[model samples]
Target: MEASPILIAIDFGTAFSSYCISVNSGHDTSKKTERYETETVILFNENQEFEKFGVEALTAYTKMTSSEASRYYFFQNFKMELYNQKITENLMISTMDSKQLPALKVFSESLRYLKDHALKALSETVAESLVLPQDVTWVLTVPAIWDNAAKDFMRQAAQKAGLIQDILSENLILALEPEAASVWCKQLPTSGFIEEQAGILDKSTVQQQAGVQYVVVDCGGGTVDITVHEVLDDGSLKELQKASGGGWGGFSVDSKFTAFLRQIFGPVLWEIYKNEHPAELQKMMHTFSIQKCTEKEDIYIECPHNLAKLAAKNKDISSYFSQLEGACWTDGNIKISYEKLASFFTESIKNILEKIKEILDTPEISIDFILLVGGYASSSLLREAVKREFGSRYKILCPYESQLAVAKGAVIFGTDSKIIHSRVSALTYGINMSRKYDPLLHDPKKRRVNKAGDYTYCTGLFLNLVSKGQSVEHDEDAQYTFFPVDDDQTEAGFRFFSTEKLNAIYIDEPGLKEIGSFVLPMPDIRLGTNREIHLKIKFGLTEIKANAIDTSSGEVQKIKLKFMSE
Candidate 1:
C-alpha cells in the first residue's frame, strides 16, 4: 500500500528560510497526524567550490577566507527585493561582492537547496522505501501583502527549482504566510510538540471565540504583514480586514546599525572595510544578529585591526568615532549601549505599530487579540516594544517557535485550505473591452467606425469583475463572456487592470495599473463574429488565475498571464 501523504512546507523568508514536513494519518484524532518536523537551510561556502546549504552551509561559510567569502554568494535577507517595487522579470539582486544575480535565479537556488536538504533529512529519519517525490505535497509560504506578480514569480522559481513538476498541479500549493499561521495556531491542539513548546494545554484558548476578532502580525525578516480575522460559531476564520504592511521589519534594524558603523568609520573607510574585510564584517554582523535577539544592556562588536589601523591614519575618521554618542571604542571593540541599540528598532517598530492602530481603527472590525508570529516576532526587543505600546488595549500573544509558525502552519494548510473561508479583495480587478456606442454614456469623439461601418465605442471600457474591499470566497471564480468584435479575428486579447477605485473607466485612468494580459487563439472564423469566449478570473486566492474557453470550438485554454512589461 502507498504510504500516507507527506506534506512539505517551504518558508522562503527574507533573512532565514526553513521547511517543515508532516505525515498525515487517515484518522482525524491520531497523534501521528500532527507529527511534523522542520529543518532550517543554512547558506555557506563548501571547499571553495560550490556553496553548501543548511547547517553545513553555515559552517563552511565561517571557515572560508575573506577573499574566498567575497566570491561566494551568501543570500540572506534577499526576499525583500520582490517587494521593493513593481516586480518584473528583469529584477536582479546585488551580492555582497557587487555581482548582479537575477532574483529568480537566487530564489530558485534557495528552493533547490531546501528541497535537497529536506529529502536527505527525510531519507535519514524515515525509511527510504516509504518516501518518494510524488508522494509529497509541497506548500510554499508567501507574504499575504505581496502582489500577484510577486507570487507568480515565486511559483515560476519553484518550478525551476524542481519543487513542482507542474505549477497548476494540486500537489503544489501556495499558502499565504499570515493565513497559514492562523490555521496552524488554531490546530495546535493536535500537534504534540508545538503545544508543549508553547505551554498551552488547550490550544483552543488561542482560537478566537465566536463573534471575537483577532489580528495576526507576521513580523518576518523583510516585511511585516498584518491581517484581521473574525471567528464564526463553527470555528472558521473570515478575513475582516484586507492584508497590508510595509518593509519595516527586523532587517530595517540591522540596516540602521550598519548605517551607524558607516557614520563612525566614514564613507571611504567603511567602503574599504566592506570590500577588503568582508569576512570580518560578516562575522560582526552575525554576532549583532544573535545579540539583538537576546536581552542585553549593551553589546560589543569587534573591530578588525586593519580597520583600526586605517582609522588611526585618518584624523577625521578617528575623531568621528571619538565624538560618537552612546558608543565608544575600547580594546579594539565598539560598545553600543542599550539605548543606542534600541534606537535601531524604533523606526520599524513604530511603523508596525502605526499599521496595527490603523487596522484597529477600522469602522466595524473590533479586534480582541493580536497574534505575533515569524522570525522577527521572536525578538525580545520587538516583543517588549509591542507589548509596551498596545499591551493594555489589546492582548498580544506570541506562541513558541514563532519563527517557524508560517512554515509549520503551511503544512497544516496544505492538508486543509478551508480554514480561511473568505478574504477581502485588496484591489479592484477588471478587463478592458469595446462596447456598443450609446449616445447617453459614450462621448461622440470616442465613437469609431468598425469594419462593418457601424459606429462602436472602442475606447476601452473597463468591466469590473472583482471590486476592491469586496469579500470573496476562497477559490471562487468570477466568470464573464465576451464576443469577437470582428468577423475574421483569429485571436482575442484581454487586458487586465487592478485599481483601488471601484469604477475605473479606462486603462489610462489614474491609479489604474495593468497587471497582465490574456490572449486566446480563436478557432476557424467560419463560426463568425458572434463566437462567444468565456473568461474566468479569480481574485481571492494568493494569485489571480485567468482562463479562457472558446465555446464555439469547445476549446478550453488555461491562461498564464504575463506580469512583466514588454
Candidate 2:
C-alpha cells in the first residue's frame, strides 16, 4: 500500500520566510497537529557565496569575520519586490554591499532551500522508506492582493527551484494567505465572547442558522489582507466581501524606526555604520524585531562599540544624539522609551484600522467577529489598538500561534480545498473584441471596412467575463465563442483585461489593465472567418486557466496565458 500523502506548506514572506509539513491522516488528534513545525529562512553567506539558511544562517552571519561579512549578501525583506507594481523583468536585487543579483535567482534559491529542509524534516519524522517527493503535496501561500504577474512569477520560481514539476498540476497548490488563515482559524478553538456566542447560537435550528460572520485581518510582515466570510451550516466558508489591503505591515514600522535612527545620526554617519558594520546592523534590527512583538515599556538596544566609535568621529552626529529626545545612550546601550517606539507603529496601525473600518462600513457586510492572524497580528500593541477601536462592535479573537496560521492552514488546505466554497473577484476580468460600429456609441475614427465590405468599428471593446466584487463559486468557468476576424488567419489571439469598473466599455479605459493574453493555433482555418472557437476561462481558483476548442475540427487546445508586467 502507498504511504499516506504528506502536505508541505511554504509561507514565503517579506521580512521572513518559513515552511511546515503535516502527515495526511484522519486519525491524528493531537492539539499540535494543526500547527506548523515552522523554520525561519534567513540566508547568510561570506565571500559572496551561498552558505546557509534559517537559524543556521543567522548563527553563521554572527560569527563570520568582519572582512568576510562585508563581502556577504544577506537578503531580508526581498519579498516586497513582488508587491511593487513598478517591478519589471529586468529587476535586480541590491545587496548590502551594493552588489546586484537577479531577483528571480534569489527567490528560486530560497524556495530550493525550503524544499530541501522540508524533505529532510519528513525523512527524520517518518520512516526513511516512506519519504519521497512524489508522495508529498506542496502548498504555497501568497498574499491575495498580489497581481497575477506576481503570482505567476512565484509559480515560475517554484518550478525552477524544483518545488513542483508543474505549477498547474494538482501536486502543487496555491493558497491565498488570508483565506488559508481563515480556514485554520475556523478549525481552531476560540475563546471569550466568540466561544460563548458560538454556544448560545443554535446549530440545528434553521431559523437561527445563517451562521456567524467574521472578518479575517491577516497582518504579516509585508502586507495586511482583510476579507469577510460567513460560515455555513456545513462548516464551509463563503466569502462575503472582497479581499483588500495595503503595504502597511510590520516592516513599515521598521522603516519608521530606521528613519528615527537617521534622525538621531547624520545620514553620512548612518550610511557608514550600515556599510562598515553590516553584521552589527543586522543584529540590531533582529533585536528590534523581537522587542516590537513584546509589551516592553522600554527597549534597550546594544550600541555596537564600532557604531559609537564611528559616531564619535563626527561632531554633528554626537551633537544630534545629545539633543535627541526619548532616547539616551548609557553603558554602551541605547534605551528607547515605549512612547517613541509606539510612535513608529502609529501610521501603520492607523492604516490598518482605516481599512478595517472601510470594510465594515460596506452596506452588504455585517461582521460579528474579527479574527486576527499573521506575524504582525501577534503584536500586543496591534492587538490592543484593534480591540480599543472595534472591540465594542465585534468580538475580537486572536488564536494561539497566530503567526503560523497561514502556513499551517495551507497544510489543511492541501488536505482539503473545499473548506472555502467561494471567493469575490478583486477585479473585473474580460477579453478584448471588436464590435459592430454604432454612430451614437462608436467614435468615427474607430470605424473601418471589413473584408466582406461591412462597416464595423475596430474599437477595443471589453467583453466582460467576471465583474469586480462579484461572488464566484469554486471551479466556475465562463465560456464564450468567437470567430476569426480575418480569413486565412493562421492563429487567433485573445487579450485578457481586468478593471475596477463593472461596466468598462473599452480596454484602454482608465482603471482597466491588461493582465495577459492567450493564443490558439488555427491551422484548419481554411474554412474561413466563420469557423468558431469555444473558449472557457476558469475563475475562483488560485490561478486562472483557459481552454480553447476548435469547433470546426473538434480539436481542443490549452492556452497558457502569460501575465506581463505593467
Candidate 3:
C-alpha cells in the first residue's frame, strides 16, 4: 500500500519563521493538520559549532552569562543579507560577536532544524511507525521581490540541509511569499479578514468571487513585497502587476528605535554596550518588538539595567532624558509618547504608502482593496497608518494571524502550483546576440567583422524574450530559434540580460545587466551555419526555467545558467 503523502511548507522569514503541515488523504489536500512558528534565530557555541535554532537559540543565548555569551555566536535577521546582494556560495555572515561563518552553514542548519522538528511532530502522529522521506513534499517560501540568484542560493541551502536529494528533485518547491499569501487570501471567506468598518458590503472588497481585484501587501520583517491580483472566472488568480517593493518592513521600525537609542546614548558608549551586552541588547530588542505590535497608545519599554549603567558612566543619565524629545526616563522604563512611538513606523509606512500609490496609479490596474499580510502587517501603528492614508479610497483588510498567512498559503501553493494562472514580468529580459549590422541603426563601436571578413554584424544586439509588465501564463513558453552566426562555430551561447527600463535596445545599455549565461555544445559541425538551437524560457513561474533543443539530434537539455562563482 502506498503511504500517506505529507506536505510541509516552510516560511523562512527574517525575524521569524514558520512551518505548516498537511496530509493529502484522498482528495483532501488543503486540510492543514499542524502549524508552528518561531523566531528565525540561531546560536553557535564557543567552538563556532552549531548549538541551537529558533526560540531555543534565543532562550539559551539569553540565559548565558555575559562572559560566556561573549564567546558565543548568535545570529538573527540574517535573511536580509541576501537582499539585493551579490550572492555566491562563499558568502559569509557575521554573528553577534563579530565572528564570521559560512552563510550556507547557517541557512542550511536552520532549515535542517525546522525539517527535523516537523518530522518529529509527524512521527508522534504515526504511532511508532516512521514517516518515509519519499512520502513528504516540502515547500519553501521566499520574497517575490528577491532576484533569481537569491532564490537559487536558498535552494542550494535546502539541498545541503537534506530536505531533498538533489536540486532537481520534484519533492521540493519554491513558492514566492506574496503569491503564496495571495493564494491563501483567496481561499479565505469574508469573515476571515478584519475590516475597520463592520459589516461593510463592498462587493469588490467583501466578496471573494470572480472579478474582484486586490493588491496583496506582504509586509514581512525584512522586506515589503507587493503584487496585484485579479480573481478569474475559473477561480484562478492572475497577476496584474509584477512583484515590487523595498526593504521597508517591520525591521525598519526596529532600526528607527535603535537610532533613537543611539542618540540618547553617545555613539562610543552605545557601541561599547552593544559589544559587551549583546545578549541583553537582544533581549531588550525582543521586548521592544512585542511592545511595537501591541494596540496601545502610549508604550513603556523596560530599559536594560546594564544599558542604563553603561550610559551613566559617561554622563548624567538624567541630562540625557532632559534632552530627549519623544520619550522620558521613568521607573526603570522608557515611557515613549504615543507620537514618538508612531514615529518609529513613519519611514516604513511612508515607503509602503508611496509604493501602493504608485501601483494604484498604473493605468491598467483597478484595485478595490488592499490586503495586508505577514509579520509586519500585524503592527497596530502600521495598520493605523495605512488605514488613515488610503482608507477612504480603498477598503483595508488584514486577516487574523497575519504572521502565519505566508506559511499556510505556502502549503496551499505546494498542493496546487497552478493556482496563480499568470504573472507579470518584473524586468525586461533578453538574450545578447549578433545580428546583421544595419548602418542606420547599429552603433559603430558594436560593429564586428566575421572571420571570413566579408560580413559585418552588431555584436551587442538585444533579442527580447519578454518585456516588463507583460503578462505571461504560468505554463506558457516563449520559444525562439537561432542559427550559428559563423559556419564553423563550435558552440552556441545564450547570454541573458535584464533591465528595469522597458525600451532598452542594446545589451550594454546603462541600466542593462548581465544576470546569467548558458552555453550549448554544438558537436555536429557538419550542420555548420545551418544548425539551429531552439530555446524556450518559462517566465511566468517564480523562477525562470529554460531549455534548449538541438533539432539535428533531437536532443533536449535543461539549461541552468551559471551565476556568480562558487
Choose the strongest candidate by TM-score.
3
List TM-scores for all candidates, in order.
Answer: 0.90, 0.90, 0.92
Per lDDT, what order, best first? 3, 2, 1
Candidate 1 on 1-566: residue-level lDDT in tens?
23237767888888677787666633132333232322233353433233665446655665667777776766566788888477777787775556566777777877887777676677677545656566688888999998878888998888888877877656678899999888766655434222233333334555545776889999988899988888777777889878999898888999999999888877988898787766566667778887876586888888766677778786743366667898987677788999999899989998998998898888887877688898898788787777888877876777787887788777767776766788999889888888888888876776766677644655678889989999998779899888887788788888888898987776777898887786788867887777999988777766677789988887788877766653
**Candidate 1 CA-lDDT value:** 0.76
Q: What is the C-alpha RMSD of each candidate to the true structure, in Å?
A: 3.8, 3.5, 3.0
Per-residue lDDT of candidate 3, residues 11-92 (tens digit): 9999899998888633233454787899999998888788999999999988877788899989998999999889888999
Number of backbone collisions per candidate, in order?
A: 1, 0, 0
| Model 3 residue 525 distance off true place after TM-score fit, in angstroms | 3.6
Runs in model 1 lying further than 4 Å from the true structure: 1-4, 25-50, 127-134, 189-203, 315-321, 454-459, 524-527
Candidates 1 and 3 compared: the better one by TM-score is 3
Better of 1 and 3 by lDDT: 3
